[model samples]
Target: MAKSPFRWIGRLTKPVLIACVIGFFSAFGLADRIAGFSANLGEKDRMVRWSAVLSGATRDAIPVTLIDIDPSTMAALGHPQSAPREVLAGLLSLAAAKHASGIFLDMDTSRPGSPAGDAALAAVLAAYPPDAPPLALARRLGAADQAGNTINALAEQASVLDAAVRGKPNVIWAASVSRIDEDRVVRRWQLSHTTCAPGPGATLPSPQLFAAAVASAHPRPLSDLNAFADSRTQTACAPGTAAASPPAWPRNPDQRAAIAFLIPDGPDLAAPQFITRDGRRVPLFRRMPARALMSASGAVVSPQAVADDLLRDRFVIIGASHAESLDGHLTPIGFLPGALIVANAVATAPAVLSGQPVGPLGATLIALALLGALVAITSRLRPLAAALAVAVAVLAALMALGRIFAPSTASDIVLAALGMVAFLSTIEGIHAIGKDWRARGWRALLKPEKPPAAQPTETIT
Candidate 1:
């Protein structure tokens, strides 16, 4: 016997419908929105934390060290509102002498300080060896303009510090700004902050991002970074154009990258400590007080031998950790100081740049395939059994994803798959309900009246 066309259509309907639904959702970014909601609910954070715990801790020494200006260091510096430039000069010189691979000064240098202090800092920067490790000084972001676009020249320290590092090959300005999500949690880092420059058709890299690039193992030249940032924008103003108005920047979504936090923060903002596979507990990043690098007279206190032992071949970050510094940020692990955040960025820069091993398209395709298989298997089971099977499948998929990809990427894919599951389940439920209703209606129509209830007529007779 020949098969009916309806039989073939019925056989292909569910799978084709499933594929269309998944394709529509992926194309429109509804899946991404669902994943983002999962992140907002802290599911991504939990996955990251759990993944870190499961991955055997690194026994290799951490490559970064933090020179924190804690409460004690603040008190020693006479409780100044900001770390004094003169004091910072001493720390810079000490790190240089120790031959640190990179030095990131996380303090504000926007406004001019005491003439002597400014001179001292400028002198240190000028005297820094051209062949020595790069020094990145943090420049604070100024208030955005009325139009909400960041003005490049408005960086806090640009006016004063720009001249300090102008002729110096080793010193550069970097932005210390971090992107805060709607929930106010710091989860992502930008490679460069694209801002409009005062000159015609000029674009500048935000200092913090520049600093991060400098701090990486393979640093890019400033010109390259600027060019890269410029390429993302659509238009550049003509030279000699008035700075009053500039071209609108392009809405490039790739400006920011996810930060992979390797070290978790400790309680009360204490130095983070973690246990390694060897069963030994140790600090994640070696931390020393800023005062330890300076003498009571504010001279370089750490001898070259000690400095080399601690800072040599390591990225050194100088920033405040005191409560008054107001530099703390809420991270996936816990509250961490801004300096620590930068350190994490530097340490994990390579991974962040590489991004997920699987792209969105690949992940979606894989997820849809798995979903199809899951539905085919579950369709043969009772409703209760089907639910159990789905739950198990989800758990297994999450575990596999965690092992195969970074926490953020894994969370996104898994959450997206769950959305598809929910959507399919709802559709199937409605179909079943409709089928039952139709069956009941057909039976009612076919059912015959039982001789008009003959008993009532018999009673009358």
Candidate 2:
């Protein structure tokens, strides 16, 4: 008797089912830990980093700059740990006069400074006109800075943060807390946060809000903080404008505004210069020493001269970038100061708002489709041919995904391809072995009976 040709199909049943399960889990992020377990295959975080890095520089220069509180600036200011409050006040005053789009000071003023200096800073901030470009002040978030009253309170504390804005109603207090990923890297960004405060409206916004506000002030509206924060897309301008309106984003109150790091880290972990659209080689965000913004006496440069050279409508972020300052955070572009991180975050607003961020759904569907196609193709070939063909095909698919899609999506495609291969191989292996087993069973079933012959022989004896 001949073996049933359908036996191979039965053998493939179990492996096919297992493969489907694996594919489903991988698609939904359930298999992330397992996939990440193998370094060569599991680099989800690195992929995320790569996606941002490959995003490349913007078509136009982002109108943002950073003022690093470097060693020289510290020496010039006659302060080691912190710049005097008066010096900062002078910076702010000059920036306001220069008509800067926004000024973000990334410092914790929770502790009181010299009484006279604090007063002078407050006076300068108060004297600014209501229509002055918005100023965002920062307060370091700690475990104590929760919803209820704690040590980080605004009232009980004689804080410079509060003193800096004593009579300045226009200044917005932005929480400087950053969300660190499980891998200890700052990838996601928070657009806004509600910090408990002492004022009538006792809530402080996130520094991202200030950045968005600055972006909104672009000659051509590039971003809308309120709409962007709420995850709603809004029309930014009329037809035929140079800027495109940002797409509507889904609202997430927890504020997981993921950072889009434009710069890529080199072998030295330093950001290398890239040629810009204008043919100039420059880093993503240019860093200027704080002293450059001031004079020999630590006074801010005259508004006319400063505007002519720098700070004319540019969004400026002032933060300590000195290595000992330890104000830097781990990012995809390597260890960078929070100020640069903030600038990168701001830089991505245009693209994110335009809804150009990578899409995983499309990639996932494509991978699954390719998996089906692979199964069909391999089923017709011999086992050896199937393995070689599938391997080559999966490699091709993985390359296409990595080059054409976001890194995360490409990784997903890779996992899907793995699942497809596992499924197909298991089926083929089982089919090959089952063919022999089925043949043996058929031979046993068809073998002629010897009982009759044995009975005749016994009778003759």
What is the TM-score of each predicted model, taking all chains together?
Answer: 0.66, 0.60
For residue 288, model 2's alpha carbon misses the true position, in angstroms, by: 0.5
Highest lDDT against the true fold, candidate: 1
- lDDT of each residue in 388-429, candidate 2, tens digit only: 887577556655554454333444566666676688778876
Please state the error at residue 174 of candidate 1 in Å. 2.0
Model 1: per-residue Cα lDDT at residue 320 = 83
Over the stretch 221-323, how does candidate 1's per-residue lDDT look in tens digits?
A: 6555545555533243333444333212211223455555775554445456542312445344677888877777756575543636577766788888888
Model 2 ranges with Cα > 4 A deviation: 1-46, 53-61, 144-170, 195-203, 216-254, 263-284, 307-309, 356-461
Q: List the residue pairs that clash in candidate 2.
A: 189-257, 233-248, 246-353
* lDDT of model 2, residue 320: 80
lDDT of each: 0.64, 0.61
Q: For candidate 2, what is the TM-score?
A: 0.60
Error at 206, model 2, angstroms: 2.9
lDDT score for residue 216 of model 2: 37
